[model samples]
Target: MSYVDFSSDAFIAAFFLYCFAFLFYVVTIAGKKWSNRDPIKHEQRWSRISFVTSTLGLIAHLTFFFTRWIGSGQIPTSNMYEFITFLGMAIMIAFTIVYAIYRKPLLGMFALPLVVLVVAYASVFPQEVQPLIPALSSIWLKVHVTTAALGEAFFAVGFAAGLMYLLRVVDFKQTSKEAKRDQFWVEFSLYTIVLVIGFIAIVFIFRGAGYQATFTQENVTIDSKGVDHSSTDTAEYTLPPIVKPYNSTADHMDSFLGMDKPLFEAPSWMKGVNAGRKLNTVIWSVIAGSILYGLIRLLFRKRIGAVIHPLMGDIDPDDLDEISYRAIAIGFPVFTLGALIFAMIWANIAWGRFWGWDPKEVWALISWLYYSAYLHFRLSRGWQGKRSSWLAVIGFVVILFTLVGVNLVIAGLHSYAGV
Candidate 1:
């Protein structure tokens, strides 16, 4: 089969392997009440199977990526869709490294599903071969994109660990068995609701901002003095200006239209709609995040102990913290090299200059800076435990903005991901 066909087949196999692994994990987590009286035996069996299946899936995933590279003759991250897939693979590799050191298979239970989700999302985009645009054909493309993605993967893992950590911190001893089961559902439900409401609110705010489009037109007219007057008509274009999700700017729009002199200019009022959309997205995200936190508290009746339980009897919070910190320590430098330095080099090569302040690039820099501060806060000032965990969470938030939010809400050159 051709490489493209082979890649597609590999994705299919990886999907099934991931699904099986996910099922095994679920069985292990919920097998306590099964016909087999020995939960420990079942857990052991399932964990073993999960590890094997996950490993197999990872292999297939890697093959798929490699085959695509061979087929395309370029780095995998030529588009937003490809970047998400790359991020998923990076996360899995990061998780594998963590697993190798700490032997924590449970983290895979959370992480594998995420990888599956990303891969599934990528499946929706067109997989056809497209030559790299002039801007993307550079060695920095690989280094910058890969490193940024690696950082995001690390941050993503950190987010999962943080959630797990938060759950461990909340005391669940006061609750009955049924309530304990309900606790997980409650937290997830609250999170989902906040996500939905916040999304709607953002849409409302942007719609309310009165987005407009401008068009430029050139007309030749004869004046009363019998002289020919060549005047450009700058009228607002009725159509909504096509603003990329991440790279919207007056300058970009001006440059985009430079080649096609205005038959008519778009209205001035519509020029800032893209910025309005971005502001709305940020506002909504904050609001949603706050509401989600509030709901978690409300669901537990304002008692911290009621919301979470300690780590599994065998695992210590300190150890979990250490594992998490170590992952960041290793992942951070790679992230810095790839996302910042390499990206800058690539941008310079592709765009004829180094820094454009594009939304994606800005967010990448922001993420890098945030993680740098995180490391400094932890190592220099000796911050640890809750403080360190919170920093990790914030660092991941910056990474999320760099990955998903930047593509979805901000208008920039990187907005091609159909976010």
Candidate 2:
């Protein structure tokens, strides 16, 4: 089989491994009675198991992509699916680094499921092998896409850690009688897992059974005046018959193939509208992510920190905050160079224009500016702890929208994502 096929299978396997790790981590969190052990010993044993499983899963994830690169003879960011997979890999690597430094395996209890969700979401996009379009055939493709993905990955890790940090702060135990902090954490963790998995399933369903494509064959018709008008002038197209399938890959590929070209077509007047749409996608993702976070807290009848109280018992909040900031500090410059400078250079080479104000380019600048403001606030405004943590969280959402959501939902020059 081709590298694409191999990478597909590997992604599927890594996804399930992450799911298994998530389940194991949950069992560990619930302790011996629910997880089957004495509380203290069970907690320790479960921590070890969670760490090992997550490490193995990360290794599998890296191997999957490396093999994909070898198979495809190029970096994996050729399309939305590849970009998401690459982004997930970067997130996993970042999480592993944080885990190694802080010895905080509990973070994986939240992070791995996210990685799985994104990879699975990516799977919903068409996975077929297609030659790179002329515009994308450049060495800068590697530098731009890979660096942007890595930057987003680090931000994703920061967001996960920040959420955990928020949960650690609010003292949910002090907030309500009905809410025990540990109970809240366990419940929220599970809920987040469900939501992530559910979103991926929704995308899969939409691509598979929820939408149809209709293509009218190229045709022409002549008028009574013998004008020699082609049928294409009057031909009408209708939605194709819906195909139901347990798996989305085949259906998505069929739909994509049936369409003669890319999913988006921009009018001349809207030449740069794709860039605006990208900004909108990024903005909306941040809004949606914040709302989802609020809903999770509401469902538990407590604040976020209350849910993860047990994990914070021996851990210092200051340390967690430092780790969160440090990760962003390292990731920000890399993100700026990759998502902005490299992208502009590549765009200039391919389209003969570097700063076109295209939606993708504009949103990328927005992300760069937002993070720059974050750093400025940190240094000049003395933004630290909860305030800085919130910025990190917000910055990540912007980075995500700039990376994945923009390519998936927006029509732009970067529409080469083949969504």
Candidate 3:
């Protein structure tokens, strides 16, 4: 088979292996219920085997990247699909290192699920390997983007550790209001992560599917030369979408189903070729996410936290704090060099300016600043435990926004991420 096919197969293999490793970790945790011997050795024996399985998954994951690199003749870091996959690979690599040092089964369990989520999330983006855009054709693309992704991977793993800290340290025995609130928010956060995975899964499973409806009334407006124009017009709506053998101009469109154009007349302010369709997809994704989380809650008959937290009992909260701190401390300077310094270098080479206030640039700067402050607060202020873990969690959220949110929400020079 060709390298392209090999890479795709490897990617699929790696995902399943990771899933198996997760199941192994679950076995390790659940086996404690039946063990009549020493808890520590039993945990170690099972967890070590799970770790070995994860290592095999990591190897397959590495093969996926290497094969893609060989097939493409470039580092596959140019688009959302590639970048997110790269982030997943780095997370697994980082997790292995942390797991080696700490040797905690719960840590692997907490961290590996996110590795799977990220790899799964990458699949939601378009995966074709298009030729490089003019601006991205630089040696700096290899160095700058790669280092930045590695740094952010550390941040991602730190988020896992922080989450572990939160779950492990919480006093589930307390029936106080503050304890209840903590429990609720923790469950909500877990629900949100699962919801995102559900959204992507639904979108994929329903690919090329469409449903239709007719709109009774549509309020329309137009701005011509700063003059306001308004009208009430009727149009069709599609739940998924229905396509027709028709073409649409900016001014004229066929009111038909099973076509690319949204039959609905979008509001004048909503500018874009497919603004209505994008809006519809967002609505559908939310609905799908809700459905998935609701089913899990119904089956468990409790909040997700109540189900998962008990298994987290033997994990050390202090280790979670330390590992998170260590990841950030190692990752921060690397983030600074790649995201700030090398990015400016690339901007100068490509755009003929080093410091254009591009939206992506601004967000990258914001991410760097947040991590800097995080390091300062932890090291100088002697912050540790929940306070430090919270900051670690918050820092990764900022890094995530810099990586994904900026690309989706804003339009700028950096918007051409392998599209």
Q: Please state every model's RMSD to the true fold in angstroms.
A: 9.9, 8.5, 5.3
Which is better, 1 or 2, measured by TM-score?
A: 2
Q: What's each prediction's TM-score?
A: 0.69, 0.72, 0.86
State the C-alpha lDDT per candidate: 0.66, 0.68, 0.77
Q: Which is the leading candidate under lDDT?
A: 3
Candidate 2 lDDT, 12-69, residue by residue in tens: 7788888888888777765554544467788778778887887787787887888888
lDDT of 2: 0.68
**lDDT tens digits by residue: candidate 3, 194-289:** 777776777676554543443333334566767666444333333443321122223333333445454444455554334444555556667788
lDDT of 1 by residue, 1-419 (tens): 88878987987898789888877776666554463668677777877888889889889988888998898888668876677777878888888778777776556656777677667656544677667877777777777788778867877777656555545554455477765654555366336435645554444444455434443444456889999986543433222333222222232233223432223222444333344334444445566656756766787675333433432444467766776688788888888888778877887777777799999888877777788888898889998876777677667767766776777666688776533
Candidate 1 — which residues are off by over 4 angstroms?
Answer: 32-41, 172-314, 416-419
- Can you give the lDDT of residue 211 in candidate 1? 39
Name the lDDT of candidate 3. 0.77
- Give the range where candidate 1 is weakest over 10 consecutive residues by summed lDDT: 243-252
The candidate with the higher lDDT, 2 or 3, is 3
Report the number of backbone clashes for model 1. Answer: 28
